[model samples]
Target chain A: MDIQAYISSGILEAYLAGELNEQEMLEVDRVATEYNEVRIELDALRESLLKYAQVESKAPRQEVLDGALKSIQEIEKEKFFEVLDDEPEVRIQRVNIVPVWTIAATILLFLSLGFNYVFYSQFKNTKDQLAALQSDQTSLANRVSETNEQLQYAELRIAHFMSEDNIHIRMDGLDLAPESFANVFWNKKSNAVFISVDNLPEPPHGHQYQLWAIKPGVAPIDAGIFDHNQLVQELKIVRGNVEAFAVTLEKEGGSPIATVDKTFVKGFLKKS
Target chain B: MTPTIESKISHLLAERNKEAIELVFTHYGSLLLNIINRVLRDDEMSEDVLQSVLLKIWQNGHNFDSSKGSLFTWLVRVSKNAAIDKTRTKDYRLSQESKNGVEVVSIAESISTGDEIEKLYAKQLIAQLPGDQKVLINMSFFEGYSHKEICENLGIPLGTVKTRIRTAIKHLRSII
Candidate 1:
């Protein structure tokens, strides 16, 4: 056979697809056996066509298989009866006076049904297992995100405290109160103080803890009212080069001037 | 135990082994369905024909020679033939061309649910073929139209249809 011409004709594609007539099929198969290229090319076409078909394929319902099996049984029953009614020579030749093909088909049919059941069950179990794993993964991801958020918050706090531009101010008790103390975290650039009322005594009713920023020979500036009862502001904003810091008990709102008699705890920003 | 399932599966199937038959059905059931559905274009009829095709594959398992082609290719050839046979029926041809006046959607959309459709070796390979080339393949392989019939339907010469199909498949040899 002129293999190249036969291949170029594209009839082999049709042939491998079983589209060729009997004569053409024989010719193609004969050449395919004789020539390696023809066989390989023919096979490749088969692979391509099947791969294409496989992609577009969908399974009929399991009932389709079950129904098919039942139909096979019906077919076998008819075949058995027809054989019993005719072909006496065939019956005598074969053992049990029955067509062995029918029995073999019946056994294969039953085996196939059993195999189908096993596959379907296995498929369901695998699907269920996959679903469970997916849900487990989702919950683990959520938990990881929650932990990440907390770690981020702690990191932010650590960064804020360790910032190079911040000044820590520790206030000791004045002569009237020896044990009272408090601390302030002042960011010099921002002119803001984060105050901690560590050991200051609770103020009397109708009075509040007031914070002050003082300069040498200058009157105190009312920084902010730090009323434990009525204030939620933890950081007080103040400005200027302060020589001293002080806290005093003031009236419910605040005092325009310092009432030094009620001075409780104080601290000055240490010079760097 | 070959690195690829192809050889091991081919071995199983060539022996008329039950496992091979089951494996083939599990793997290529949708493929057979898709090929038939593409040809028949009717779900119910396609399924009936699909069952029949599967039976033919099973009954004639010994006749299948794997050295010539992989089991999948043989199964595909069987499926396409079965589908094309259904198309040749008068009732099927009439319902398809006359009753269903709408231009059919792509084969990809019809076999919508299967995992195989996701891979769409069919869509990628055939869709890449220029418009007429793809149509020519489908008309011949899926619709069971002969080269003459395809040429007549498309009003092209016989040699054009034949050569186009040949080249298109030859092109796929490289791509696949």
Candidate 2:
């Protein structure tokens, strides 16, 4: 978001007045931590409010301070309880209100307000439900990575792989490793390549399988290195154009150049 | 700016120093008294409430964590709670309810105005605020109302209430 827009959201002001609910307060805390200016602004608002409070401050009678100071030194109650001057003053005074009509009006107003509050809360609950649904709609797949949403993402990936914009390079194991196979989901437009291991034998702990993109006579591009235990791995960075993709066994870090002799599985685009 | 009183608060509490309580009372006594009076509006009661609040601060010294908030914020919150308790007392509430549903803020304001020191302090900062912003501050801070409550009472949308009050605070901050 625009920093200025976020700063102007008035969330900070609500935060200062303690008007924000728990969720909103957490948001304010997070925002204040991230933005230096927000913390500064929050501090300034607090200082200004404190000063205002001080302006309205009235000094208690001197006797009260004496009582307070006595309480401070001795927290033990029994000694002060019997002798000290602290007493619960019967300070309330009853005022006779002669206006019966206003009381009747107040009762009626309270009844109507009570009903209005119920309806307003119901409306608020419905709005909350709709907001929850909208959030689900936007990030439905992201919410569950280990369950139904993961299945959805898997389906989406498969559909994209099979789409017309994608080039599917099927790799079968070489003569030395004939049981292995893999597939590359190569999206040429975005230059993204995801590898799904079909039946490749796991390389030993100290070794790895590295994918390379070769343009025939040119030096092969290092697609990426993958952990032997991984079922699928997406190369971090991929550039446009490649004639063939190949996997080779290499030392753990992978080699700058392909280990040409160890091409366990290889595939080439049918130059169209 | 001088050092924040917050940095020294935890030390004072941890040491359980009597002199420290005196220092805190000298600096923040009026502020806490004002806050309680805003809620309770009785000098007689605010006196007792302020003592209890200060006693709580002394007793609960171990609970003060500076990371949670500044010392002033925490003190004001405790004062507000004590003031609430004062107002919630059966006698006080019954007496207050009988006052024709009108609050006694004017009486409290008059008392405040009589204190030249307090009046000057109040006017110095609060006078700098625009009329609208001053009212907003009064409702939000002194009356302890929420943003939504302010919106409902003022007949404006919540967004306008938030933005206007915030911008006012921003302008207030600049002058301070």
Candidate 3:
């Protein structure tokens, strides 16, 4: 490179004036760094410009420095707060819409989050209320089923007692339970026996009332155990002729043989 | 100032020492104010801009790279740019446009009206340069006008504008 030609090209003056583009500036920087004469010439130009500006120098008032110091203190305070907050400062650029849009988007995001939380709480509450309603509905359905079952049992007992073929025998209470009595309904054709206890004493825990059917000159046969609380209960069938019906206190399941001392009630069927 | 003292001041500025601001005001504040004043041509606004420019230097002092240019060159560039930006404002333009011929004439006449004898002599020294060179220097250096702007404003080719600036700076270098 011709050093003198490069110096006279006027690029250094443009560089000093800061009028060159970045690429041109870098090129000038490279040339000035590589060549000693170029650097000296550039420095001389900068000095001349500095001296030219100095010729017109005028001192500012002391108040200006005071104002500058106050401004610097304010800047330092803002920087300190920025450090404490650990949030980057929002720099607003003139003639640009992006920063305004950024602030809007941030506010919208927070609002969306708040709305999401509210909806989630409402959804959870609604779900819990729905579950509670479903439980109530299920309990109501169970109660209706129980009432239906009781109605069905009452209808069956009424139909049994209204039948003409059923023979009802009254069983008187013995000495073990003098106040207790029971009525037995025996279907003539089917030989099905249903016993309805009027006032039977509550049996001990693990003890229940068992009914027996006795035929002439035959041993008493086990009919079935029944809950004293039951108004009407069906017992085992006696296919042959039944001479008498009796109830005895026994264990949970009926024993094969009836205990004589534990008998609570006994009744003889009218000879038909 | 010695390169040693300049390097020390650069280090202090980079470290953000408060003393560096004081030193900057004492050393280069007037020079920078003059750079700003050339563009503004108003004492109050120029003084205000000079304070702001000082604050800007302190805030961005670490960005100054000595390898690019002298600190004084960088300061001049910063002050000139700030002043130029101020002139681009609507308020400045409106004020300039609304000013009567008398105010404009007074502003022009006030450029040479200073108290110091050396300042008067320096003003004459710049006036002693050839008219074309003087105008190029004033437009390019003091006014912060670009080569392209100078070409468009003066109706000269861009090359001629740059060559004249170079020739003018070389002439000022010899005389000043």
Best by DockQ: 3
Interface RMSD of each: 5.5, 4.7, 4.5
Clashing pairs in 3: none
Q: For residues A164-255, what per-residue lDDT tens digits would candidate 2 score against the true structure?
A: 87888998889968988888878877777889888878787777899999885788889999865667677855666688899999889989
For candidate 3, lDDT tens digit of each residue in B56-153? 88888899998886665677778878888899988778777776576646534433334333343457656566656655775666554567767876
Q: Please identify which of the two predictions, 1 or 3, would achieve the higher DockQ against the true structure.
A: 3
Per-residue lDDT for A118-230 in model 3, tens only? 99999999999999999999999999999899898878767777889788889999999899899999887777889998899989999999999888898888888898998
Q: Each candidate: fraction of true contacts kept? A: 0.36, 0.52, 0.52
Lowest lDDT block of 10, candidate 3 chain B: B110-119
**Model 1, runs deviating above 4 Å:** A55-272, B1-16, B22-44, B60-128
RMSD of 1: 37.0
- Per prediction, the TM-score for chain B is 0.50, 0.63, 0.59
Q: Which candidate should be chosen as best, given TM-score against the real structure?
A: 2
**TM-score against truth, every candidate:** 0.39, 0.43, 0.42
What are the per-model DockQ values?
Answer: 0.15, 0.21, 0.24
A10-66 per-residue lDDT for model 1 (tens digits): 777676434555456666666776897887776566566656444444345565566
Evaluated at residue A2, the lDDT of candidate 1 is 81
